[model samples]
Target: MAENINSIKQKFIIRNKLGLHARPAAMFVKLANTFQSEVWVEFEDDEVNGKSIMGLMMLAAPSGSIIYVSAKGEDAEKALLALGNLVEGGFEEN
Candidate 1:
């Protein structure tokens, strides 16, 4: 039998100067693809697939903008936490 997974939603702020730019979006996509879950990012009224670089870019979440992340699957919690950490850590930039 397949295990039931729950979905979770959390908010985050962009601390990086570039916001969700190409490089960071790519990174986010790569990270999202690592797990077998559905991940999405929401800004205002727009929602984008977290695993898609183009989708993430469309959000144009500038620095200091509040964003919402939601994930559903076995790794939902872990994925959200990791992604939250990624954003909070400034996309792991120097």
Candidate 2:
């Protein structure tokens, strides 16, 4: 029988000076692609695929913006943790 792993979800706040700009958006997409799970990000009532640069850019999430993230698959937990850490780390641009 196949193993069952439910999706993992969490909330994060942008703490970087640039927030989720082009470069950081690229970073998020890159990281999202590294995992086997399907990742997504949400702002307010909108949600976007975590691996899509255009989707993330549309959010215009600036510094201190709160966002929600969810991942589902084999690496769901790791994906959530990594994405959360990436945001909390401020993209290391500052």
Candidate 1, pairs of clashing residues:
none
Q: Give the runs in model 1 whose Cα sits over 4 Å from its true position.
A: 1-3
Compared with the true structure, what per-residue lDDT tens digits does model 2 show for residues 1-94? 9879779889899999988899889999999999999999999878999999999999889999999999999889989999899999998776
Off by over 4 Å in 2: 1-3
lDDT of 1 by residue, 1-94 (tens): 9777889999999999989899999999999999888999999999999999999999999999999999999989999989999998899773
